[model samples]
Target chain A: MTDFAIDLKDVDKLYGGVFSRRVHALRGVDMRVGRGEIFGLLGPNGAGKSTLVKILMTVIRATRAMGTVLGRPVGNKPTLARVGYLPEHHRFPDYLTGRQVIEFYGAMSGVSRHERRKRAAELLDFVGMGKWADTRVRGYSKGMRQRVGIAQTLVNSPDLVIWDEPTDGVDPVGRRDIRQMTVELKRKGTTVMLNSHLLSELEMVCDRVAILVQGKVSSQGTIDELTVHRQRYEIEVSAGDSHVDAGVRKALAGWLPDGALEGRLEGGQTLKANFDSPHLPALITVSTADAQPVQPIIDALRNARLTVRAVKPIRPSLEDLFMEAVTDPVTGRTLAPGAKEGA
Target chain B: MVLRQTLAILGDAYRELNAKKMFWITLALSAFVVLAIACVGINSKGISVLWWTFPVDVFNTAIVSPALFYKLIFIGFGFKFWLTWAATILALISTASLIPDFVAGGSIDLMLSKPIARLRLFLTKYATGLLFVGLQVMVFSVASFLVIGIRGGVWDWKIFVAVPLVLLFFSYLYCVCVLIGIVTRSTIAALLLTVLFWFVLFLLHSGEQSLNLFKLNAEEQTATLEARAEPLSDQIAKSKAVIAQLSEAPTDETAEARGRREGELATKNASLTGLELRQQSTAKDLESYRASLGRLKLWHDVLFSVKTALPKTSETMELLQRVLTSSDETSKLEDAEQQRREERGTRRRDADAAKRDADNEADRGGPGFSPSVVRRQEEINRSRSVWWILGTSVAFEALVLAVACTIFVRRDF
Candidate 1:
């Protein structure tokens, strides 16, 4: 009955027995997801992300747990009626069509037939899967299956919808649609807790994010609060016109070197992974949270006689924050080398 | 509401059964088997209701009455091995996946995470598996019920008991399968283990039964020996006591008393000698039985206990024969046929088999004949009440299911 939809503390899960090699999946982790907020769990592979969710759903038994889900103790069957979960590696029974699968899961949640039928139609449309409703899930592509998975998650109109890697194998467009769906869910005051390796997608939709590293939540807060510690201001000084001389471009290049631009030295934490470096765009987005003021960079650009295109304050992206949280400073070893390598 | 969810699971599972064409194929095959059985029927006039033979035997035609035909088909075929092994095995293979499929990776989590309790989910799924066999047997049982009425003009409702009876017997193996499937979550392993367990149990039961017959024979032999030896033992003891008393009555007595005492001693000694001879013969006769009695008792206790602890599968199947027919009518028909054969003066070699057929029918829920005559057919038979057979077997199945459910609940998906 608390304001939080999920309040879990000191949940520990161990995978094996004594006298055997045991895997510590979750280590006395304490977590809470606020009602109506989009909470993203950011973690590497084997970082205990799915384990934590599975524990809450009672799919995997925790060695120890002190928690309540939807205001009831974890593993409470009735409370699960109000909680929905879409597993990370979920697979629908192939014999059933998408609509039947949706309805079957809906019925399992005790949704009435009339309501299930109506919500199925609405949810399929909501997930942009209206056309594939009657098609057997065996015929579905990965993205289409994800769409159906999302649609089924809404069958009971759960108050707390938890999805693990909801857009893992989805196409870019499907990922955007999923993000919009979460936004809609939040707008309607539904608590959404999702775990995804797609930090950019999570950043676009997550109001708050928890970065888990090696069976522990290393950092968690609103995206802005966590990223504000390392903000970057970029002075995109391009030759405003292509006709600008090569001398001007060369002088501009000196002001904006193709190296780590020093923002303020607040703890001097270096990023272990690049952010938004897809295809290495011409636009150099620099973060100023670590080093000097933004005004100097701009003044330097003006002094170089370069036409300043635009100067924008750049906050650290979730990927940067994730890498910083999970990466070792000295060795620069990612918490999950395997997880990163999987991609 | 929980019940509703259980129903939903049952419904969904049944629909999943439809997802595989093999189930329908199995159902069709079962129906065809029943239809084939239905084709070979007998009428009240003792003629084949389906068709007559091409070259009808003009002379010495056998009389096959409706009652006889119905017994031959219903109890003889339906209750014996047709529905027991053939139909039950088919039903088993079709329903083997019911459990494994329910606990299949992604499916189990969604179902278990629902508002329903895990025990309920497990029980409902278990019931759904039973429904697979129940429906199959029901179809066949009802068809047989119809054939009994249509061909023999008797709507014996007892014939329909095979529906639940078949399910009860099938459950003996399915429970084992479910227990394994819950732990291993592999259909082939579960099924093979169940079948292997059954074969092992069957062999154990048969072995015990043979031992029981031997023990019973030893018991009967001991009783016969003891009966004969009892009279001789009394006579010999009395004669020895009389002779001792007469000798001790000695020198204080008068001449007449001594003479009478001598006469009595002579009579007692003579009788004693006769009794001793008979006693020795009886004791010699009893020795083999006494020796075997000890060994037989030990084996009987071991076999009997082992047999009782396991589910009573043979007795459970026997329920079909018990409920579906009567022994009195069979024995009466047996007598009438014997009388008719005697009047005709033709002693066929099949007479012994016909006598055995009647005895076999009489063996279930009815007192069997003397042990000596039925040795080849002793067969570790029991006249258990329907309740005892069904109740004990169901109890075993429930116990197995309980253990399996506990494991399933505790284990992580």
Candidate 2:
């Protein structure tokens, strides 16, 4: 079997027929999620995040696809028995109770009656919905429904679970519960794929992530790999009434030569010396995550009797990676939000 | 796996119907209808409602048996009116939204993501929609079975056939509803268009039957005219021969005898002319009716072919009539009723009144009541075999469902 729970290659989805207005929802998207890992999919609104998840679940047919989900070709009916999906804005029948909803979906997934009954109860209590298990879903609040939606997804004990906006309409406590459940699923060797706009939540739980922009995957990798190049260290020196006191500038004169204040250091790392005029600290930024390179700058400030207030290492966040993926590099403006229209 | 999925959908459908107040309301109405059937009784004197007997001569128990009366009421009022018309309408209204709601955005996503195939999912849901009518008809048939047994004193097991018959009849229309629902995804459109389709079927059926009645009437008229013409033509030939014989005097005849022969010859000629006049009138009528018959047959055939290609809703329901009552029993009832009417006519009519009434009746439907218009209509309906009635209808339903399944399977929710 393939190591990935999902291995999609060159997937494309065109929404309408020739006579109608068409949308190119997904344009050659390639994505992968390794087994026993929590993978996050982040995108702007209408960027085809949901569309890709749907294609894997066989909810939408792709125009051109080459991939396997759980070691079977995409859209294979039998393969879905090992997969679970909680769609965005999923609506259960109002007539069914919470427990009935779970049991019904479990039965549909080919789970036997006794197992369905047992799992439904356990899952309901796990989601903290045991008190409302017998109540009809029509009377439940949105957060309650979301909890039930999550419970139903796990009824079959799927090997791969894809949840789109699992924490939508949920309170903070509920969101935490969902996160913990996702982690628990991963701990049990289940591959969890989550698509949500809550970047912080995904950042906390995801081992790897793919950022989609305008129907294409702009970046895909572990957080450390994606943020490695953008990681840096900031050295702030105390500024006098003149913003950057003469002592601070004189101390860093080697890194910032007279005519060129920003240049490469001896270690071949980018070093930019900032001397602000207003009442603020004069800063030195080293474009390397290694702490060895920043020790000399701090030593120079100290030997010159210049106050060295702080030296800190900064790593780009998932949100930062998300913003960079969606932004137009040439224009320095955010890219248009939606999938493009095509012939 | 398929069985489990199918049972899940069926269970969901039952729960959905259980939640709708209309389901319980319809069941209550059916009970009331059965109770109402139980309240009305046929007795030795006449029809009885509750404790009161309204004296009637023709429909008394002596003329109609309790078994036959109850069967008639069950087939006529219970099956035809309540189950076919009223209950079917309620079923359509309640279940019209089933397909549209099933394929709705969020709902369909959940269903389609399951391990089941799209075609199987769609078909199971479609069958589940019929659960509304199936349950309704089952309850109605069971109650009527009890009523017919207890009240009419005949525990006819055959009454249960109404359950499947009515369900089949409703399926013919429900298939159309499902097609429209899948296409438009609007409950109102599906319900209205399905009802309209049924009305068109009713109109076509009525048209075929009406044209057949006229065709039969015209054929009867032509036959009567031909029968009258034969004797009149013989009489005319005989009169002419006698006149010819009398016009020439015998050699031994006296003048007085010859003059008497002349008078007799004149009388024969006049009689022959009158007979010839009737022959001319009959020939004219024969031509008219023959022409009318040709026109009626053309239109009837046209309608018959059109109706043949469509589901036979009326004929499908009439299947119950065949299984419920024997032809012999109905014929006996009809003969008794006819004899009673004739006896009443004898008491009410003198010679003049009788002749006037006969002429009036002749003008009404052309010659001798057309010899059982009701029986002829029943014969036309009964001539339809089970295969033609249900097979063609099921073929039509299958065609419609095929189209619907294609849409449901191909559509992206």
Candidate 3:
């Protein structure tokens, strides 16, 4: 078994063939999920997030894929016993009760009868659906169906669970329950791969995340690793008498050799001095996660008798990383959502 | 694992059908039919409905044994009309959405994500489509079995064969339904197309049967005509020999002898002319029959070839009849009816002949029927091996299912 719960290498999916219209849904993607972590897969609509998940689940065959899910080759049927999946917009037969739906899928996953029945009861309660377990799905609201969907996913006690929008259509309370469920599943050493559009929710719970744009992964890492370069310390100061820009520029003149200071610090952190504000306080920014690099600037402002109003450290949010991934660098606009056409 | 999955799907199918009001509705209808069958009784004097007796001379117990009579009714009306046609249509309407619902976007993804192989999952789902018919037929057959046993005074286990035969018959059409359901993914399209396919099959089967009847009748007529012509031809030759011998002048013959010889020659010559005319007429009849036989055989062969490649829905159900009652019993019933009709006199005969003529005219525009024509048609049908009937049909179903499965397994749900 591999150390990773999911190790996908060079995965590719082409929806249609040469003679027909084609959609290169997934490019050559290489992704890895650690054994016991919540890996969030964030992307825009049609960005191939679901396509990649389905390929791993064997719901859609890949044009070419090399990976292992749950320590077996991708698309291996038996290995799916250890891998649970809750598809987006999943539909259960309306005739069945919520409990029956769970047991049915559990049986399909090759879980024994007694075990699945026991787990189904427990999972239903775990998802807060125990009260409605015997209710037919036909009578369920969308949130109820979502709760049952999550319950069915864990019925087999899978080691790796892939949930595509687990909180879809769920109420806030139910969403929190699902979030807690993932954490509970993690506490038991289960790998959870979440694909959702809710970046804040993922930011609250995900341990690591991959950002896919136009069928390619733009970046993938822990939140800190991804936002490190964008992390900065900003020092806002004011001249008690005169314009803040002039006071700040005059105070930092020694720190600038050519009347401007815009370069990397000695420790390879980016540094820029801003003095263009006429009415606002001039700002000095350092592109490093460390606070020590900004202390000297704070001391220099104090020595110049310029009041240092605030010195704050800032780090980019998950939404910021997501937006940057989807936005085109040259166009300064969001890239067209969805997989690119052609090969 | 496979067994668990199979049972799970089967259980799901039962629940699905259980939820459909049509399933129970069809079952209730079946019970009504069985009860209706049970209420009708055959006494020595006549046929009875509950307490009331309507005397049917030919169909009475004196003419048909109660066992054979009830068997015939069950096979003809119950099995053929209700189970195979009416209930099958009901089952089709109830279960038509099976595959389309299965492969619907949200549903199929969950199934495909399961650990079961795609082919197994697809085939199991397809089989569940037949489950509606299977349950309907099973309940109907068991009920009919008890009806026949209690009312008819015979417990024929062979009556239970309807379960499998009807299931097989339903599957033939259900397979087509599944293939269309997979391709179109629309319940209405699947149902309508499957019914159309069944109609085509029925047409082909009926065409082949009608042509075979005509062809067999023509062959029998040709044999009869040939049999009649032989003696007439021999007599004509003898008359010619006698006339030729007499036509020569005799040496030292008296006038009376000559006159006698001339009279004899004239008689022989006249008889010869009459025989030759009859021979010509017989030859003409033979030619016509042979020509008709040739044409009938050609058309029958064409339909037979086409029908051979398709499922034999009627013939498959007919197999249950063959198993339930022997030909001897059927023939006895037929002979008693024939005797009763013969007692009615020449008027009945004339009407029968006129009807036969009309029937022959209707059947491929051919003429004639031997009493053995019906039996000959039965013989032709019975001549088909169970293997050929079911095997080729299943082969057709398998082909359609294979195509459906290929699409199902390869499709990106």
Candidate 4:
């Protein structure tokens, strides 16, 4: 079995005074991401996403935590050497130009001077920021800075890339480019751990995702697995004039005892049905005044006389699945306090 | 790995220093000092009156004159300009920003994450500070020498040796200031402490001198006692010779006889034993006061010198001990011994003074002396005690520095 690219077992983080005050940023957070997978950590603000990242990076110590990354203990230097991190709101030294910042970070990762220069050039190009490499970071716009931030993260060519709100403040175009680059990195066998509030962007790219709520893993799995509760199936049919109005309805009514049907009549004769079911496979008996072959039932639907007018399924999106996971079962409020609707 | 880390830290230090405007200010100040020294050397009137009084030997005039002058001036300047109130202020200002900047800039996180050891980073930064101070001293020394050479025509190569010694002293002082800056993390507090220390030292010196006045009074009493112990035989002979000459040459017989009798009476009074003389001397209230004053003064001088020397000696010994002891050694044997010696010396001096005071009381006819003289004696004693306390405190500061450095090296930072 492939080793976990990132793993945290029973991690806890406590802040503030020993008594009278405390903020449990993380309470027994358990997470695992497989190698060569783009894993999205989706959460609203203050959902412990940043805390988990900091613990993994060793910037903040975790209480009662044990974990490993790439077979080494989490936060180990060797493991860090193979990991690239872009913080949520990091500010590079203003005095240093984009090229200089990249070179410096590359050097810190133990890259040779010549290789640092080479990699810096290549990474800047990869992030579509080659032209502005000589400009000081102080002068860069938010989008430009985000681009440079990405460029710096790739300088080490790390085995694992962790980006915290990487596309924050980025324009839509820049955000799309970043998403594309992330996918490209994953294609190149680099594992990406993305922490973001952008659920739609994550939905477009992440192979698997975990929703963190109130410092714990609320739900985690592939998109398809999480939404298995909502099942769907599509059916096609053809019919004659008499069968269209009465027979189709009768058949659908018999087939779906506790289901909803939605479709349009293609012609005077053809009909299509869309159904939602708690379970599948029901008996259907149809009687028509005019008889029609099974081929005509299918053909009429394809042509104007029997057109294929509708196809609908009961599949739930990643958003619906996420909401289901984060919604507290007791109060029916979001597990993340102050989480807004549709967020 | 260590070398690379050290170089990186040094580079950071150098870069930071270069970026600071105070570095330029310090450079400008050093240049000004050198120019001032040069201008003074160029103008003959600028030479101190004291320097001109030193007798110039014909054989050594060319070398010794300039060398001696430079040595004196360098030593003076070492304690004056190089160790100025401004230098400490600058040191405090510069070093104070070192750690705070790292923390504020978030550079500490980046640097600490490296494989480099934290203590080594600290040491490298400290060494950079030393180097900066050394450069300032060297610049001032060389420029001053060049000016002096051109104007006074007294260029002695030996004078250059003062450069490193002065630099060493400044470096040590700056190191101490840096340590203070690290501990207190306040530039103003560190500078205030440095200034306060120097002011206290000045106070101690003045206090010590005032205490020495009692010793001078004692010397005066001894001289007076010797003068009062003249022989009666010589006085009687002189008196008889003067009376016979008056009888023979022209004076009235009645007047001459009266003069002779008076002289004879004075001679009889002068022919007293040492014990009787002391008794007679103490009978006079002034004489008794002088005797006690003398005893107080003698004890005061001895105790004062011991008090001043003991701390300095102990300080020097402690500095030596610090140099000799490895950081790993748990026992500070030499430092403990030095402390013991200093305490013992102080106690012994006090005991000796007490013993001498007791003896003086026995020798004096009685304790009936003027209040003013006694007050003066007490004042002298008080000043001496103050001096000793001040000296010990100064030496204690050096010991504090040693301890601070030791603790600093072990701190994780």
Candidate 5:
């Protein structure tokens, strides 16, 4: 069995025929969304985020696609019963009440009427739309419509839920609630693929995220892994003289990994750890581009006859990674994937 | 499970149509219109358009059979041209947007994303659009039934045949609308094209009918010219033979032979000249008549083929007559009436023409009598079988739907 809720390889989608001006929406996209994880797809306006989500949801057809959803073949309708979708710019029938809209969609998903009613009530309240349940959607504000739209996405109780711009018109509190809801779904073992322009919202809740640039997966990994600068570590060495003993200095020289630090420790402060965390106060801070362990830094500080106040690792924010992934090197502030040059 | 989804989509479609205020308004107007038509009762005098009470005194209870009179009133108002037009156009325009709206991008995504098959969804949407026609006509038929019972004192439930018949007729045009709507995704464009299609069908049907009548007339004229020329050819041949025999006769002796030969030659010459003149005129008439027939035949062939290719639209609607009118008894009355009229000879006429005038006016939109006229209506309907008329129309609809569904399923949202 596949280890993913969705597994796609070499997926390509081109809008219009070859004779026309074809827009390549997705270019050889290979994606794996693991089971029971909240995966965010972050990208620009035409960056193929929505198109990718839609392909998984079977809302749009791919020109050349090979994949499976729910571990079955892609575009499988029976498997779609276990998948839910909320499209971007979705508009509900204006004549139906909010409750009716949910029930109607539930019915479309082959949910029993009684179950639809029960689920509608619970989901409407869950989305803070209980009061507006009986009101026609035409009179509801965009935020309210988004609330209903979200509630409807859960109507089928799908195992895999794909939401495109789920928090598009949502207010701040609603965005927070949506984030919380994503976490809750993850806890319940639901795999969610969230497509959103709200990078900050995604950063808060996403376990893993893939940044798409020009229809390609430029970078992808866990939030921590993507943002962390592993080579950089801060050793909080107190700025004092002779808090160190002679034996401790010798231990510091021996404890350091051979060639781990580029420069040697000398009588002054030459063989110190170079990188540090940005959140800490004035102390000894060490930074390096090399990937290494943190234990050595702790050991070195302990040997230096000074208290290791804090040994911290520094990392970039999600925005910094996103900018670095999407922007051109020459015209952009970010130097490269691993560069900390701008910061 | 497909059934449930079908029902779900069908239910949603129902709700979509039900949400329109125009549907209800049209229903109300139909009810009012039908009940208002039921108010009048016909008699020998004339129709009472807005009858509030039974004016039994104004009607003459004698002359025609009361049952025949009441049936005339029922059929005349119910099947009149104006009512058919109004019902058809109103029901069509109101339900025009159902398909376009269902296939609208966001809305269609919700449906197509379901486990339901796309073709089934499409078909159910079609059935849903048809539901409008079904409901509208059923209501109208029932009201007409009640009216016929209450006013005409004719409680024939068969009047309800109009329900399916009208639905079938309206579908002929509505199918074109649906096909256009799928291609264009515009409600106004669909409705306009459907109307235009109906106009073209009307022109073609009328053109065929008129051309057929002209062909029949030309054939009759040609036959008459051929019969008139036959005897003239015989007379010309007899005259030429006699003229030859006289020229061959040997000359006898003296004044008696000369005088007799001169008289004989003069008489034969006059007779030959007159026969030749009549024969020439007759031949020219035959040529003119045959030429007319040839032209009519050319047009007739073109129209007949065009008519055959199209669905039998008017005939499909006309199928209502088989159930609406009394067939057997009406046919006997018509046969006897026609026999009697034929016996009245060339110069003198009968009351049949006057009665026919009154019947035509009533059928146009009023009230009068004739069990005989029902035979012609029945004959026109029976020319095509139930299967032939309805089957061809449904085939047209199916072809269009197939094309639409193909476009719908293949195109990416």
Candidate 6:
């Protein structure tokens, strides 16, 4: 088993005063994320996803409970050194150029000046922002800024990277590039904690995911485990005339000797046998004037004695799993997972 | 590590100052102030009129060049000092929005996620504020000197010393405003508080001067009684009779007292009545005098008991020292050792007080200003424009910044 990079136990976060009103951003969340794994936190708007990320980063303290990242307590400065973060609405000094921002963040993380310069170039290139590195961030587009945000996150070469809505404004191409980069980061043994509303992207990149609804984690698991209940199977068959059916019945005597035949008339001189389970293949017979035309196997079935139906297959998708997890099984109102359905 | 962190913080502060529009605005304001002052100085008619109103004879000293005299006049009147202080504070408040902006924009998340400590970031912003203030002061001094030299044809190198002192004063104010900015997280609130503080200090200084005048007038009037024909006993008897008669009548005290008290009693009654009319005037004046003696006691204590119950400067310093020393376990031990030295000094003072009390206890000495009277006299003598400006700015900024930082650091943002 891989080491757990981030472990949270019954963490709860309440914002605002103790006597006044508060927003229960995270309610008893328990999460254990494995090392070198891409874990996606999927939720709708105001679903406590960002709150969880903030708690992990120590930007917002958990009102009650315990958590650790990379063996250090959450919010520990030394631990922060091994962790990189990109907030949902990340903004840098507009006066600073892309290169300067990266260098500044690198310097803040205690990276040497020479190393910072080299890494800044490399990261700028990695984010496909090599040309725009020298240009001020004021002129950069949203997608470009998102790219720089990604670069900044990797500047520390942190063991764990937390990204909140990293692709909110990113175009499809940029999103794909980031997804590829995330996969690459995972390959390099970095644990990525991603908080995103984009389910499709999460499905593409995440090995496992947790869905939050109404300030609590509704469900969490691998995609396959979540969708196993929705699996299905199918079969197809052909039919033949009475004479051929009688011959087929004689041929199938050994396979289904005692079972009563269930038949349906399709067209002239045609019979189709249907069985539920543990059924065996049956035989057919045909007659013709010429020796070539006397081939019964094809002529009997093609002449409406027996004919094969079309065959098709289906499999459950991530969307199907998400819908099942989010929706109420009975009323289908998208209730929280594990909540009892109202009769 | 501290030095490195300080440097990083300084860099961060510099970056923040560079981004703020107030930095430029303050620079422009400083230039304008210097230019305005230079215009007033170059026009001989304006200088002559201004000097005529002041009591100083430096204005008439023939040895001093007109330009040198004008520079001295500017320094003495604190035109540059006030301008720099006001402009720096205004600019600092505008720049104070830096941290709040970062919080609002969610950039703090990215920043805090780095290895740098939060305090370092805070201190860096403060240092950057000072840097901006320093730049503005330099600009103002250089501009004022150039304007004066071209217009008044005078150049004295002594004026250069004033530049550093002015910058130092501005730095003190800037540090204070930055501290306020860090604490309050609202530039508007910080700015308002700084301005209100300056106004209150001005009122206090003016109020103290007026009270001294009234005290002097009372003293002079009391002196006249000794020279009058009436002996001390007869006058005392007359004062007692007037007090006894007035107790039975519901007459306006001012008119009654004026009619009864002839010379010394009249002056004493007027000053006493003045004290009674002003809220906490008597207690405050006494406390001010005591504080003015040597203890540096604040007037707030005399005016309001409940307010005084809150933490005072010594308590705040203790808390600050505790926070710094206890930041790490190893440093805490070192702090304990240093605290021992301070205890020794306190013990010595206690011993001295015990010795004095033993010797004086049987005497039952009449009421008088305590032994620290000399210290008080010195304080009163030393109280001047520069001292008032320095003391007021330091106290006001320190309090503002401390409160601001505490609130901002603890706040959710």
Candidate number achieving the greatest DockQ relative to the actual structure = 3
Question: Comparing candidate 1 with candidate 5, which one achieves the higher TM-score?
Answer: 5
- Candidate order by DockQ, decreasing, is 3, 2, 5, 1, 6, 4
TM-scores for candidates 1 onward, in order: 0.79, 0.93, 0.94, 0.60, 0.80, 0.65
Q: Which stretches of candidate 4 lie over 4 Å from their true place?
A: A17-20, A230-309, A313-322, A336-343, B42-64, B68-84, B105-413
Ranking of predictions according to TM-score: 3, 2, 5, 1, 6, 4
Which parts of model 3 are misplaced by more than 4 Å?
B239-278, B345-367
Q: Write one digit per residue (lDDT tens) for candidate 4, span A1-343.
A: 3388988799887665545356777778889999999999987677788878877766556766888877788657646666777877776666577887787666656666687899999988989889999988889999988888888777778888889899999999999999999999999999999999888899999999998887778888788766654534333434433344333445444332334344323223323353223122222221222233223433433453433433333466778877877787899986656222210
Error of 4 at A16 (Å): 3.4
Ranked by lDDT, top first: 2, 3, 1, 5, 6, 4
Record all residue pairs in model 4 with backbone atoms less than 3 Å apart, i.e. clashing: A238-A297, A300-A306, A301-A306, B218-B294
| Candidate 6 Cα deviation (angstroms), residue B346 | 58
Candidate 3 positional error at A200, Å:
1.4
Give a tens-digit lDDT track for model 5, residues A138-194.
999888998898899899898988888889888888888888888888998999999
Model 3 agreement with the true structure over B318-353: per-residue lDDT tens digits: 898789888888887878766654455445456686
* Candidate 6 residue pairs in clash (backbone atoms < 3 Å): A239-A305, A239-A306, A239-A307, A240-A305, A240-A306, A241-A305, B183-B404, B183-B405, B293-B376
Pitting candidate 1 against candidate 3, the one with the higher lDDT is: 3
Query: DockQ of each model against the real complex?
Result: 0.53, 0.76, 0.81, 0.10, 0.54, 0.37
Residue A200, candidate 5: alpha-carbon lDDT: 82
What is the lDDT, from 0 to 100, of the residue A259 in candidate 1?
41
Instruction: Assess candidate 1 and give its lDDT.
Output: 0.74
Clashes (N, CA, C under 3 Å) per candidate: 11, 0, 0, 4, 9, 9
Docking category of candidate 4:
incorrect
Candidate 3 per-residue lDDT over residues A123-153, each given as its tens digit: 8888888999999999999998988898888
- Write candidate 5's Cα lDDT for B49-79 as tens digits: 6644344322433333445555554455555
Q: Give the top-scoring candidate (lDDT).
A: 2
Chain B structural similarity as TM-score, candidate 3: 0.91
